[model samples]
Target: MTTAPTPVPSSAAADRDSTRVGGGAGGSRTAPKNPLADRTAPRRRLRPAGGPWLATLPLLVFFAIAFGLPAIAIAIGAFTLSPDAPSGAGSFTTSNMTASVQGAYSTALLGSIKLSALTALIGVLVGLPLAQAVVTSRFRMMREAVLSASGVLANFGGVPLAFAFVATLGNAGELTKQFKLTSHGWSLYTFNGLTIVYLYFLIPLMILTITPALEGLRVQWREAASNNGATNWQYWRHVALPILLPSLLGGYVMLFGSAFAAYATAAAMVGASIPLIPLHIADALSGNVLVGQGNVALALSLDMIVVAAIVMAVYLPLQRRSARWLS
Candidate 1:
C-alpha cells in the first residue's frame, strides 16, 4: 500500500468529481418527468354534461309518436284552407279559426266555459268543507274511508261513470222513478242535469286535491291564535284562509280544466243538446251538422289548448304560493 501511494487515474478522478456533483453533462441534473402527468399527448377536453333527458328518452320517444305527431297534424289541419277539399288543393289560412269564433261555434265554446265554471264553483263550495271535515276528523276510519272513496271517484270518469249516473238519475232511472224527478222539472239531460252529473266526479276530485292542503294546517297555529285571544272565525279569516286560498284556487282551476276537456261522459249523457264545445267538436268531425268543417274541429281543439294553457298559467302561480305552506 505504501508503494507509490496507489496512484489514481486522471480520467477516473474526474469521473469521481462529476459523481460527487451530479451525473449529468454539465453537472446539472434535470428533474425526472412523470409518465402520466407530463404526457405530451394533447389533452382532450371533456364534452358538456347532458341533461336528465336520457332517463326520459323512452317517454319522450313515446310522446313524440303518440301526442307530438298528432298535435302537429292538428295544427296544420286547422290552418289548412278547405280541409274538406281534395288534397294538394288545400292551402294555409286562418279562416277556420275565424269561423270557429262565430255563430254556433262561439256559443258552444261559451257553453263549455259556463259548464266548467259552474262545476268548478260547486265543487269548491262543497268539496272544501268535505275535505276539511275528513282531514280534521278524530276518527281515523272515517278519514280513510272518505279518502279511499275520493281516490276511486276521481278516476271514475268517462263513459262508465256517465252510464252509472244515467241509471241512477236518468228519465227512467231508479232515483227518478222513486223520487219522480222529471215531474218536478228536473231532467237528467239538461245543462243543470249535466252539472249534477259532473258534481259526482268533480266533488270527489276536489276532496282528493284539497285534503292535503287542509291537513297542512298546523294545529299549533290555531292554538297560538287562541292564546292571543283570537276567535276561531278570526283565526281562519286572517291566518288560515290566506294560506289555503292558493290551494283552493289551484284546485278550482284543475277542476275547470277537467270539466272543460270532458267529452265521453257528456256525450253519453246528453248527446249534443247542451251545445258544449266538445259536442261541437264532435259534430265538426263527423256529423252532417258541420258537414265539411273538419278544420273547424281542429281549430276548436287549438282553442281548447289555448284555454288549457291559460288555465295552467293561472294555476302554476297559485300552486307555487300554496306550496309555501302545504308542501
Candidate 2:
C-alpha cells in the first residue's frame, strides 16, 4: 500500500513558520511600501522623437540664410570671371585663385598670419595668469567687475576703438603731443600700434575663454597633490597645465581667427600701409586702387574661409576634449 502523503501546511501555518525562521537572529521587520512602486504612480508622457529637432529648425534656417547662402555665393564668385575682364567675362577660371597668392597678395597673407599669431601668443601668455588670479581670488565684487568689463571691452573694436586710440596716441593728439611720443618712436599708425590695439580686445577675450577652464580645476586635485608631497609649482607643471592645454590652445586659435579677420580698425588706422589680407580684400572689392578685382576679392574671401575652417577643425576637437575632462 502507498504511504499516506504528509498533510499540506495551511497558509497561516506557512506564514508562522517563515516568521519564526526569519526572526531567529532578530525580530522580523516589515518593509515600508513606496507610494510610487505601483500603477497609481504618475507616468511621464513620452515626447515625440522629432520635438527636439523641430526646436532647432529656426536656428538651422537662420544659419542657412545668413552663413550658408553667402558662403555659396563667395565660392561661385571666386571662380567666375569679373565683368570687366578683357574676354571670357562670367566664365569659370582659376586665374583669380592663382593671383590671390602672388606678389602683394601673398605678402598681405603672410602679414596677416604673422600679426594674428603674434597677438594670439601674447594674449595666451598674459591672459592665462590673469584668469587664474581672478579665479583664485575670494572677492566677488572684483570678479564681477572684471568679467563685466571684459564682456564690454572684448566687443569694443573696429571704428570707435580705432578713433579712441587715435585721439589718445595719434601724432596730433594731446597725450601724444604732451608726452612727445612721436619723437620717442611711438607711432599710432604702425604695425606695432595695431598689435597693441589688437591686444586690447584679445586679452579680454582670452580671459573670458579660459575662465571656465580655470574654474573647472577641482580643490580635491590640489589636496591630492599636496598629500602626495607635490609642491604648488609641481602640481601646476604636471597636473593643471596638462589638463588646461586644450582650452588654452582653443583660446589661442579663437584669438588668431579674430585678429586674422579684423577689417574696419586696420582699414581705418593703417590703410594700405600695412599689407593685411582684410584690408587688401576691402581694396580689391571696392576698386579703390585697382578696378575689376572683384574675383580676386572673392578669392581672398575663400582663403579666409579656408583658414577659418582649419581653425574650426582644430578647435572643435580641443573644445570637446576640454569639456570631457572638465565635466
Candidate 3:
C-alpha cells in the first residue's frame, strides 16, 4: 500500500544537483566565474613605477652635455680633414689617422706607452707587498692609516704634486740644496726622475686597488693547503697567487692607464720639451707651434680611446673574477 514517494524540494537536494553539474567526477565544486565581478577594481596589480629613472635623468643629461658631446666631437674630428669644419662627406679623410703614425706624434705615442708600462710594473711590484702586509697585519690602526694615506696620495696628482716633488728633489729644492745632489750627478727633470715622481701616485693607486684582493684571500683555503702539507712558498705560488693573479693584472692595467693619460704633472714638470702624447695633444689644442693641428690631436685622442678599449676588454673579465672571490 505504498503510494509513490512525494518528491521534497529541499535546499540540500538543490545544492547536490548544482554541485554534480558544475564539478568534475570527484563532485568537488569550485567557485563559479561571476560575469558581474569588477576585475578592474583596486585589487588588481598596480603599474610599475618610473621613479628610479627620474632620479638618474639628471646624471644622463649632465653626461650628454659634458663627456658625451666631447667624445662625439673627438670621433667626428678624428675622421675629418679639419676639426674646424662641419663633419660630412666633403670634409671626410683618413689623413689625420695616417698622419698620427707618421710624424712626431708617433714618437710621442711610443714614449707615453713606454713610460706607462715602466711605471705600472714598478707600481705593481712595490704596491703588492705593501697591500699584503696591511691585510695580514695585527694592528687595525696601522692598516686604516695606511689605507687612508693611500687614498689621499692616489688622488694627490697634477701641478701640486709636481711642485711637491720639485720642492723636495728639484735642482734648487731643499733636499738638493741640503745634499748637493746636482753636483753628485742627480737630475730631477730626466726620465728616471719623472718615473720616480710617478711612483708617488702610482704605488698608492695600486695599493688602493690590490688591498681588497689581499683581504679577499680566504683563511679556510690557507688552512686546507696547510693540512695538505703545502709549504708557505708553495701555497702562495700554487694556491693564493693563482686566485689573485687576475686582480693583480687588472690593477696593473689601471695603473698603466693612469700613467699614460696623465697631463698636469707632466705638463707642469716637463712641459713641451718631453715627447709624450698628452703634451702633443696639449700643443695641438693650444696651437702654440702648429697653426691648425686640432685634427691631429683628435686623431691622437682616438688612438688613446682605442688603446683604452683594448685594455678594458682584458681588464673587465679579470675584474669580474676578482669580484667573485671577494663577494
Please identify model 2 stretches exceeding 4 Å from their true place.
1-46
TM-score of 2: 0.85
- lDDT: which is higher, 2 or 3? 2
Model 1: per-residue Cα lDDT over 1-327, one tens digit each: 555667667997766555563565766554455787645444533333464677788999999999889889889988997645656438888888999899999999999999999999999999998988898799999899989999899888889988998899898999999999889998888998999889999999999988888889998899999999999899989999899998899899989999999999999889978899988998888856946788889999999988888988977887788787865
The lDDT values for all models are 0.87, 0.91, 0.88
| Residue range 120-218, candidate 3, lDDT tens digits | 999999999999999999999999999999999999999999999899999899999999999999998988889999999999999999988888889
Candidate 1's displacement at residue 168, Å, is: 2.3
Superior by TM-score: candidate 1 or candidate 2: 2
- Write down the TM-score for model 3: 0.80
Give the C-alpha miss distance for residue 149 in model 2, angstroms. Answer: 0.4
Who wins the TM-score comparison?
2
The predicted structure with the larger lDDT, 1 or 2, is: 2
Residue 105 of model 1, lDDT score: 92
Model 1 clash pairs are none
Model 3 accuracy (lDDT, Cα):
0.88
Q: Worst 10-residue stretch by lDDT in candidate 1?
A: 40-49
